[model samples]
Target: MARLTKKQKEALAKIEKGKLYSVDEASALIKDVTNTKFDSSVDIAVRLGVDPRKANQMVRGVVSLPHGTGKDMKVLALVTPDKEAEAKEAGADYVGLDEYLDKIKSGWTDVDVIITMPSVMGKLGPLGRVLGPRGLMPNPKTGTVTMDVAKAVTEVKAGKIDFKVDKTGIVHAAIGKASFSADKIAGNANELLTTLIKLKPTTAKGVYVKSIFMSSTMSPSIAVDPKIG
Candidate 1:
């Protein structure tokens, strides 16, 4: 195993071993432990007691963070000419149809979120191999595929984000950046946790949220008390 650097060792020392921190405490501690030159993203990892393999127990939904995610989301609005003006007005970084489709066909998915209309979804179906693995495929459930292209683009530009449980039953999402105030980080984390609690599947038994951890891009994970909202 690679030896830990002096800074890494010092960061790990700050965390109390076997101690579960509250949401606010963990958020603050994460910033303190982050030593990266760049503004590292603050992420939350939630372990749920549900089997993602079972459709009924799958947990997936969207939540708008009170304080916007520190990163500027690059949104691609794939709409017809009629909706081009509306998409541009909604702050979409890229707005077009066939040209953008051709770009996507030629292995060019450089945007963060792709928002398209229901009518255009048929054409996108064939490009699933390229978009699916990258988590860029527009899905109706995530509001990425909708007739209201403007609304979808605006929401994504805001702090709206979609997250789903992985096969291991862990839901991981970037809440904000380390540069944000502790309060902002805690608020975003609380909003996501509240949403996850509300989305608990009826088929899921026992503890819905098994464990919660908060950390920065390169910092050691801080154990958060799951009971704390």
Candidate 2:
């Protein structure tokens, strides 16, 4: 195994062993532990007591962070001519149909979120191979595929994010950036935790939230109290 660096060892020393920190405490501690020169993304991992393989226990949903994700999400509005103006007005970084579709067909997925209308979905179906793997396929369930292009684009640009439980039954998401104030980080973490609690499946018995961890890029994970909402 690779040895821990001096910084990594120092970071681990700050975290008390066997101590499960509260959301507020973990939020603050993560900032102190993250030593990256650039602003690092603060992520949360929630282990749920459910089998993701079971259809009845699958968990997935979207939540708008209270303080907005510190990073500005780049949005591509794939709309018809009439909706182009609306999409542009809603802060979409790119707006168009055929030209953009051609770009995507040629393996150009430079944007983060893609917002397209239902009518445009049929055209996108053939390009699913290029978009699906990258998690950029716009889905109606996540509000990315809709007739209201403006609303979808605006929401994505305003810190709205969708998350799904992985095979290990852990729901992971980036809540905010380490540069944000402790209060902002804690607020975002609480918002995501609260949303996960509300989305608990009835089929999921026993403890819904098994464990929670908060960490930043290249930083040691800080164990957060699972009971926190």
Residue 29 miss distance in model 2 (angstroms): 0.5
Question: How do the residues 1-229 of candidate 2 rate in per-residue lDDT, one tens digit apiece?
Answer: 9999999999999999999999999999999999999999999999999999999899999999988899989999999999999999999999999999999999999999999999999999999999988889999999999998889888888899999999999999999999999999999999999999999999999989999999999999999999864
Each model's TM-score, in the order given? 0.98, 0.97
lDDT of 2: 0.94
Q: What tens-digit string does per-residue lDDT give for candidate 1 at 1-229?
A: 9899999999999999999999999989998999999999999999999999999999999999999898899999999999999999999999998999899999998999999999999999999999989989999999999889889998988899999999999999999999999999999999999999999999999988889999898799999998854
Best by TM-score: 1
Backbone clashes in each candidate structure, one number apiece?
0, 0
Residue 36, model 1: lDDT of 99
